[model samples]
Target: MGAKTALLAFTDGDLRPRLLRPVRTNPAELVRVLHPGYEVTPIEDDDLGENTYPPYDTSYVAVLEGAELFCDRRLVFDPPSRLPARVLEAAAGRRVIMHGMHSVSDWLGFAVWENGDLVRSLSLSPDGGGGDNIGTPYEFELPFWAGERPVKAPYPLPFHPLVLGQAALRAFFGFVNEGRPSPDDINPFEVALHGFRVADPTGREQAEREAALQEFLRKVGPPRQYKV
Candidate 1:
């Protein structure tokens, strides 16, 4: 389970059907709309699979007929309930969906907003249990929360977070990051996305962000040495 994603979408209604259409898109304009005030330089074109978990300093964006998607690891907010105000503003009056997963930590999170109102948000991991869970469980989430799909013994959570993560990915985005492709699943490869190198205009913000990350890493220190 090496899959990972940091995806955000804003659409009029169902995104899956919109993605199926072959509509021309303006990726640069889409990036600008979502990342106002940031310096965005068009870099390359990439398919969904390759950009789902794009680099922290880069973003992959696309504007469909009535839908738009932006993928960047920076958008993977912990306790997704606290999505940045700017992002929420961009999603105003539109149905917004966000999904984040890190296979290394077996963590999964997802959030949904309808017309600027939060409908559901959840984030969880084995090591930390539920990080942030709000609103009622969606139909697709019921089975896992009910213990119907239990995790292996010796695990803390009722189910493997990543398993639920995959389910969430399919449920919200009409695709999966792993597993065999199903006939009904959306062919993300068919959807083209534009990549951009995003940076702050002043360079101060980027430096501060890097300094914070370094400080955090310093506190966490190196991995523990153990004999197997």
Candidate 2:
């Protein structure tokens, strides 16, 4: 349950099939497509087999057989419907899938779009309750929404958001980050990705962002422990 992801994909169709066969691509070119005017410097080769989540000011990108994926924590939005227009434009007329989860906060947000139209988008956590729920529930989400999977007693939400979070990963992306892998599951390790140092031209944006995070952490202090 400690696993985390910040993944976005643009695919012609099902990404799973395209992921099965790894394809080499120009990481720089892919980054330009997704990032546009951002300053990008090649850093190293990364893989989706692990570490799909990139750190602040970094991104892991890949142009697969028929899919393109970018991993960066900054992609996780409170309500996935607010995904930047530029990013969505990269997949105009194709299917776009976004999967974001933070195990520390037990938060999950995901969305899917086809042919420039949103089909489903959701964000929820026990602490924050539901954020945005648009469109009808997909088939894979039925069981959780139907109360078939209930959280243990003393929990606020009916189901663990992370549990359903993992389910959404497998359903939308054909893999699970924190659960037992199925034989048919895509071996994320086999998927090749390239890493890059992405930053604003002046470096001021990243500096200010880090400063804000530090201030927030200082105010929050140390983590508190609780017992059942």
Candidate 3:
């Protein structure tokens, strides 16, 4: 089996009007926008470092002309690329949000960062109506100005219905904002979260991995139709 990979979502530069066109719905167009450079590079397995999981080589770089998306090994969307450029454009030079659904624990978590400072984080559990124990979905809006303040008070309600409590949100921001190294620099969480470790992937983990992926999709909900 190939090495496992974690997904990292970010926008590379300033959000431009031209890049804000709605994401194309055509599969070919979608593939083109998603893999703009079209070069697949081999990522060092060891480079994945400590986090929540092993790192896999970036199989492709997905761009919608505005946003940059990446996947370690598997293509999570139907057309192999789902990020709309507008989304990236909206996040450029500001905050980026990342959401993950963990199948092992049926948990959904999300984090927000602005200029590399952690702003918010959240997580949730299945509500019992979903199929196959898929974890809950998570959603949060990040202002482009998130890093202006050192810490913001917790919200009365979770930004998303699936997100359970304030503690997760606090932890998310703390994990990103507290002067930790980048995931590639050293172990990002090493100094921040002392006992945290990335999970080792194994052959027996396939079933659970698939379930976790499904849960992730369920939480991501549906992609918006591209208008332009």
Best by TM-score: 2
Residue 222 lDDT (model 2): 88
The prediction achieving the highest lDDT against the true structure is 1
Sort by lDDT, top down from the best: 1, 2, 3
The 0-to-1 C-alpha lDDT of every candidate, in the order given, reads: 0.84, 0.84, 0.36
Which residue pairs does candidate 3 place in steric collision?
5-56, 34-62, 34-63, 118-177, 121-169
Q: In candidate 3, how many Å is residue 192 off?
A: 36
Residue-pair clashes per prediction, in order, are 0, 2, 5
Task: Return whichever of 1 and 3 wins on lDDT.
Answer: 1
Segments of candidate 2 deviating more than 4 angstroms: 222-228
- Which regions of candidate 3 are displaced past 4 Å? 1-7, 12-58, 73-92, 125-228
Question: TM-score of every model?
Answer: 0.88, 0.91, 0.29
lDDT of 1: 0.84
In model 1, the runs with Cα more than 4 Å from the true position are 205-228
State the displacement of the C-alpha of residue 75, model 3, in Å, after optimal TM-score superposition: 14
lDDT of 1 at 87: 80
TM accuracy, model 2: 0.91
With candidate 1 superimposed using the best TM-score fit, by how many Å does residue 214's alpha carbon deviate from the native? Answer: 5.1
Put down candidate 2 lDDT per residue, 35-57, tens digits, no spaces: 67788898888788676667788
